[model samples]
Target: MTTIEELLPDDLLETLRGRAAGYDEDNRFFTEDLEDLKAARYLTMLVPEEFGGHGLTLRQASQAQRRLAQAAPATALGINMHHVIMGMAYTLWRRGDHRLDWVFEDAVKGEIFAFGISEAGNDAVLFDSVSTATPSGDGGYTISGTKIFTSLSPVWTRLVVHARHEDQLVFGFLDRDADGIEIINDWDTLGMRASQSCTTKLHEVVMRPERVGTHTPLGPNPDPLVWGIFGAFELLLAAVYTGIGERAVNLAVEIVGKRRSHVKNAPYAHDPDIRWQIASAGILMDGVVLQLEKLTGDVDLVGTGEEPQYGGKWFLHFSGVKGRATEAAKEAVELAVRTTGGSQYFRRSELQRLYRDVVAGLYHPSDNESLHASYAKALLGPVRE
Candidate 1:
């Protein structure tokens, strides 16, 4: 029998590698590529073996996310909106529907899932979301509210809704086709242009009590102090940041190395100021990779449901990885621009799109302001990670 891993050849993903860096210009759309990924069974890397999946480890999952990011941040962002959850949903669903044998198998076959967290009011962590779930007449609950920037909404069959039900935090799984739910095509984002992070709405949708399954086990729901916490998830973001930085630097170097040297009374790539920026970006990318490996290794060790020593520091580590990687990635892209000269900014060039898209990672959740507060909380020493 062919394994799920065997089904998703690196070549297929690699074929798309340049696309991530080339996204907006290429007119790429998940609705267009997603079927092919599903046909190849590329999304099942995380489903547990019992669920008939390749069940790749956290390291493997992180590496896959990086590869996809390298191809197209939007592709990775949309696909990984499901990819990150693939492996773990097995564990999560195991606690609920054992029949996920079919779903898990299908996921490896490229079915996807996405998070419905960012809404009209809650684009970032600090903002409050408008979505809510309330106790319906029966054991089940009704979910209603609008969410914006909900990526992969078009392709995903399920959405993991993080909601507040009567002042209590809970999550729920909602079907895209449910009677009361509607997905609106209105992301209109400046960067990550093809990600399709649109608006979604649910109007008093109902779910069977059992389907509630421990809280919206729809996508990547982090269960505090439990299996939901891991650097694999956070570091995946780091890997994307690193991948963007790496490509931006490489493309810049390629452009600079070929430029006229000493033709304009200047060394071009050899100029000290330009050289300094390239060198800085190189070091910054290296730092991203190092931090990624360290956090991945650490998280894999204690991903168990049990409490561990690193637990207290995990949140701080998240802040640092998210904070630093965002800065480093953006800096590298900026350097790529400085080194490539004005021609690189031509509206049609790949560099332009790469520069624009890479910037989106910087503003993703855990922006610098939130990262600082997270670090501050960590330093206080009395609270948890």
Candidate 2:
């Protein structure tokens, strides 16, 4: 029973942890991590068995992702975009939809995939796109616009982007070497620096029509693509933060058990208040982990045609999970810092980096405001627009 937890060997995980600090310090992409993951065939974890992949279910992948995050938060976060995209394709394929089979094909062929649909000021999310994709008069379209937060920008071989084409929102794939695609090296950020989530600029980039996977009217509809993206992204994002929280709890416990006091102490682990704080953080994290297990497990139900009974309810659930997990990560990190004393405040400390990285979970989609609104809608019916 080689479970997802064993996907990354202890030695590999240690190397990742050792390099994490240097990568963050230099604001560099996790190139070595990516290479190791590729060698392990992790990039194709979700691809079908016929495609020479592990064919792990979404649940297993989510578990593996959490474990990966424990070793390198930024690396896991960056790789998550790719995994979520693959998860989306898998979800569709499992339900007899072959529209995205090409994505899986590409994945099995060692081509890196990056999700580039997010845009600045287009909070409408999957419903709208600020970028434009006009007919190129050759059964293709010319996409022109800028996409921000394009993770894996420095290494991805292919990028998937969405843009408005007339009254429809269309999503297509672009090659990294595409003639008019430019990756702006402007991803210097306060946290998750190793992600290299740079801005991507499209200048009349031509994409073949076959590459256009989904096209829908510019608004909500009974489209599984939308649901898959929302589901996979939120769930996996939650998993990453949950991993960060787990690490924080472990670190807190280790520090409290090791730090000694000259006055009257064997170690602070025996101190009532220190134990209380660590216990509290552990309890919070326990709730998050249980929620993750449930959500990821139910994702299979979504792929098995049981989605209609739940309908839009899963979105609300996922929002709650993402919000709760991120906040719990922050809380756990804060408690870890407090228990570890002032030594964690220094830049060289791993706790210092975890503190910075955990806060970034706040910026992802289904943010606090949106999460509240969605929860309200789910509980109290739709509010007046």
Candidate 3:
């Protein structure tokens, strides 16, 4: 029952916000913020109570992410990768699958888990991988491939990766210092700079059999693992972007209320056009947050032993939510920037940073194009693949 409000005390949240600009300016990882989060037990929020965590449900965790994001989007997002993987393991364990219990236990004990599944041009999503997972005959796998956008690159203790093994798509965690593991710190980017989501190269990195978690075939299937990952990742990601939108709207409101219009001798908030624009952003943000609450709340209810009512529809909903929320967040940020005028374009402005950060959402899975294609398939029946 530990809310984000409790975990991130007001003073800590202020300190984090105060440092966000410095981290973004240096294009460095939010090392100080990460340590603060760890100390606050934010990293272990989703782990089970028996494992020394707050045992927050996914719904609660999603809210926590949103609140954290409102303070520091990049920090919240970078750490969200860890939460997504841990949420998956804990969820599976709660649903009577104990295979990934070790992952949850370690996470609760303060182990940092980083996501390492994305690859260049491998848009098969989770169904396929460009990396290879060659069996080492001792039941282990010798993984050899590069993973791009590997978040938490500098400090991950365990990396959850997905790669191909003949016809099967293998997935599991590996020690950060495992042989052949290399981290390339070339994370210069437009937004989420503090995330330090860099490139991870694996040159025949070896993983023990115990480390390999799941092996599903290379295509769409009715695997709960797939559902769990997609659900947690998409929903939590949406929440983070939504937080950005929320913050942007609030900032715009504050700035507009203080800026005087030269002709009218009144605040910009008095202008009908300015009020309408900020209102539109607020409305869009409201819709995104409502959608997140609806979907995550449903998932929480389903976790109580009932059949998954959403089924495949869950993924569709997630895709829609993620795509829409991201777009909405981007729109909100853009509006905030416009409302603030030329002053926000500077590197020192938080709105400028947020505007860039929101763009990163467009690159995540369920991009606008992909979401449209899926919607077409869902609504009008599938075209020839």
Candidate 4:
């Protein structure tokens, strides 16, 4: 079996790491990194072998993402949106639904897919949409709405989007050159700047009948499409943050080994307080690894003809792991910065860059507020009216 290390070799990672600072500093899209990844066929990792891809499972793909993130987080994150779309299609196909087979086919042909689901005020996410999808008199739909945080916008050939169609929610793909679609290049942010996840506005864009994927009832249910999206999205997202934590811990260890304490006349690694902080960061990272392994392994078991039971706790499982991973990653990064002292505060320091990038975790879906509310509802049932 080909490993992630072989695919994303040390040389490639080093090259990416070398350019990370420049991308972040200039707030530019990771154009060079994207080209490198494309040459390596990283985008089609989840597509099956028969489709001319590596045919890696979600577990393997998540591991690959973690390694890529350790090199350049923004690069990994920008590409992650494409993998998430591929993973969702793979999830559906694994369960004998071939409606999304075209995703794999297009991916093999090098068509990049961008996620266009987020809206300004729509917190319902995946369950409801503020965008409207009106019938276009020929079984297709004319979608009109704005989608925010559209990663891979600079290069995506196809965009997967969803909109409200009366009582049902419609999912479809829009070509980049399609009429009435506009990509706003306003991706300036505090961190993850290289992702270039800008805002996309749809002015009654037409989605052909063949491009329409799935339709589900409003307000969440047991739709396989929903499960596919949540499953691939949450786990893959957690992997990126986990990689950030791992990088922070590794950097801290390296710094401690080389820097000596003036007060103690010895390396900071010998100091009990520094050691404790590093150890705490490692422990938090370990918990995230354990959670990722269990969840991703269980998800991959479907390929072996064995379905792991979640007992109606699937949402909690997915969202909860994401919440834990992101929080743990943020805390771990903090501890690392503390151990490294004042040097990490400088803009030139990689640790400082990691610090800024990790802050974006608090903003992703399954946020603290939603996670807490979901946990409460899961444990005690929905609240009284």
- lDDT order, best first, reads 4, 3, 2, 1
The sequence of per-residue lDDT tens digits that candidate 1 reaches over residues 183-213 is: 7766666677677877788888876565454
Misplaced by over 4 Å in model 4 are none
What is the Cα-based TM-score of model 4? 0.98
Residue 162 of model 1 has an lDDT of: 55
- lDDT scores of the candidates, listed in order: 0.65, 0.87, 0.88, 0.92
Candidate 3 lDDT tens digits, 282-320? 999999989999888777765576645765677789899
lDDT of 4 by residue, 35-71 (tens): 9999999999999898888989888998998899999
Cα lDDT tens digits, model 2, 112-218, are 88889889998877779999989988778989999999999888998888899889988778888888988899988999999999999999998887887778888
Compute the lDDT of residue 40 as modeled in candidate 1. 62
Instruction: Name the lDDT of candidate 4.
Output: 0.92
Question: Which sections of candidate 3 miss by over 4 Å?
Answer: 305-308
Strongest candidate by TM-score: 4
TM-scores, all models, native as reference = 0.83, 0.96, 0.97, 0.98
Return whichever of 3 and 4 wins on lDDT: 4
Model 1 segments beyond 4 Å from truth?
1-14, 17-28, 87-106, 123-129, 215-233, 262-267, 303-308, 381-385
Which pairs clash (backbone N, Cα, C closer than 3 Å) in model 4? none
